[model samples]
Target: MFGDGEHDDGPRVHQQRSEGPGGQSAQQHQTHLDSIFMLLEENIVTFVKNELKKIQTVLTSDYPECLESQREDEEVLDGEDEEQRSSREAFLNISLHFLRSMKQEELAERLQSSKSI
Candidate 1:
């Protein structure tokens, strides 16, 4: 329905889009699986760092004058507020559930063991 050298960049292009839920392509699904798998293998150093930043902000904002002068040796979980702890726990469980849904029993078990600790 087009000239020899022309292309259809309208409905035809849209029709070729992924049928996967949330409009994710096959490659996207593959990348998601790979990412979760890597997270399982890497054991959450990144997650801990992120939690540290959040905890630091909350502590400094609440009692800056006291904490800012202390220079204390602190850990990420040392000042974890209830909400932050809950968020971290929820993420672990969500990841575990996703792994299980993908039939990754081994990874799910690993996550479960970690979560218990």
Candidate 2:
């Protein structure tokens, strides 16, 4: 079917029929399979998009919490002393690390769910 110069933008299947008491033509069976595959693909795409939206929502909601916590930590380290600067840097690093871990976990869960599908 490749390079047939037909410019058909559809699924292609081999046309080989099986003879049986109640059987469908090879073309008919292939068409049915193609339809089923196309439907399945669309469903998968929709599911992934939905999952991504959920992830986005979760991230958006979590953002304010992150910012608030950072602000609180900074308030606690109000002094410009060396110890306070060091503590602030440490807190920022830890916060960044925690956020990265949370994002990684979310992505891993998403991938696991997609694999299940």
Candidate 3:
């Protein structure tokens, strides 16, 4: 009864290699996996852009004034608001504006690149 089944491991191995799922080969399965990876990468980049926009709206808002007032002694707001703070306030505001603008430009470039690809 067991004689035919125990003939050898060669044909069993060959059969396994030649069949997958309903019987697609290994190369066909790899193409599907590659496409899934590309789609996932695209989704992650989109999520980052949306989250950054939300944060940008909050940071550049008048909420900074209220937030700064609370941290007056901690130096967190040491030179943030111009009319209220010292001479350094204007420079700080300008510096923050430049940095934010640079970040936005970089984000735009990345989004454009992703779309182009």
Q: Pick the candidate with the highest TM-score.
A: 2
**What are the models' TM-scores?**
0.35, 0.39, 0.37
lDDT of 1: 0.62
lDDT of 3 by residue, 1-117 (tens): 566667544556645675455677877777777898999899856855643443343343346664443344336434446654443334334434665577866544443333111
Candidate 2: minimum summed lDDT over ten consecutive residues — where?
108-117
> Model 3 lDDT vs. the true structure?
0.50
lDDT-based ranking: 1, 2, 3
- lDDT comparing candidate 2 with the true structure: 0.54
Model 1 lDDT at residue 14: 50
Comparison by TM-score, 2 against 3, better one: 2
lDDT of each: 0.62, 0.54, 0.50
lDDT of 2 at 37: 100
Model 2 over residues 1-117: C-alpha lDDT tens digits?
A: 557677875655445456533587666788888999999999867855654443344344446755554454446446458865564345434444564687776644543343111
Summarize candidate 1's per-residue lDDT along 7-70 as a digit string, tens digits: 8566776567565657789788878889999987676667767644543443344466645433
Clashing residue pairs found in predicted model 2: none
